[model samples]
Target: MNKYATCPISTNRINERVARLNGLFTFLLIMLFIITRLWYIPAFLAFDFLMRSINLSKFSPLAYLSKGIVKLLQLKKKFINAGPKIFAARIGLLVSSAIFIFSLIGFNITAIVLASVLALFSFLETAFGFCVACEMYPYLNRFLNRLQ
Candidate 1:
C-alpha cells in the first residue's frame, strides 16, 4: 500500500513565508488567550481559521497581517501546495472552536491544555515549517475511510 495514499493534493499554491508568518500570529494569539483567559481571543481565532479554511483567506485577519509583514520585509514568495494548508486550517478551526467552547463552559484546564497543544503546533510551523496537521492527514484519512 502507498504510504501517502490518502494525502490531500491540489494544484493551487500559496506563499510559504506568509503561511509561516500566519502561524506565528496564531501562536501569539493562542498565548495571549492563555495569559489573559480571554474567550474572545479563541473565538476570533476560530473565525479567522474558518475564513482560511473556506478559501476566503483575504478575509482572515491573520492572513492580512502576515501578508503585510511579508511585503514589508520583502520576503521572496515560496509557493507550496495549498491542499495541506487548507486541511490544516480546517483542523485549526475545530481546535479553536473547541477552545472557545471549553472556556465558555468553565473548563479552564482543558482549554489551557488544548491551547498549549495548538501553540506548540503553531510554533513548530512558524519556526521549523513543520505542519503536524499535514503529517496527520494521511492517517486520519485512512481511518475515516475505514469507518465508512
Candidate 2:
C-alpha cells in the first residue's frame, strides 16, 4: 500500500490538488482526436481515477492511481457538484493540444494562431495561478440554482 492511498482526502489541501489535477487532465481530454481515437478510454478512466483520487493526498497518490481500472469496471455516477466547471480549462488544454498537434502536421491553416492563443492562456495559468476553469464554479452553481 502506498502512502497517499489509505488517507482520507477531506482536507482543503487535498481538495485543491484534486481540483488542479482534474483541471489539467480535463485539458488533456479536449485534444482526444489527434492524441488518439482511444483517448476517450483514458479520459473517462481518468475521470474515475480522479473521483477515487479525491482521497489521494491523505494516504498515497500512487495507490489511488492504481485503482482507476477497478473504478472503471464498477462504473458509477458520482457526479462532481461543479466538477465539469472546475475542469473547464482542461478542455481548453485538450483543444489546444489537438490544434498544436494538428498544426504540426499542417492541417488547419490557423493552427499556429490557435496554438499560440491557447499556449498563451496556459502560460498565464501556470505563471500567475489564474485558473479560468475553476473561477466559474460559484457562478455556475448559482445559475444552476436559478434553473431549479
Best by TM-score: 1
Worst 10 residues of 1 by lDDT: 1-10
Best by lDDT: 1
RMSD of each: 0.8, 12.5
Tens-digit lDDT track of model 2 for 1-148: 2322322222232233333444344334434432443434333534443433343322433224423533555643333333433254344535455664555566654554554454444444445545554554456556676999
Compose the digit string of candidate 1's lDDT tens values, residues 1-148: 6756777888889999999999999999999999999999999999999999999999999999999999999999999999999999999999999999999999999999999999999999999999999999988898898999
Model 2: C-alpha RMSD to truth? 12.5
lDDT of each: 0.96, 0.42
For model 1, what is the alpha-carbon lDDT of residue 91? 97
| Backbone clashes, candidate 1 | 0
How far off is residue 130 in model 2, in Å? 2.2
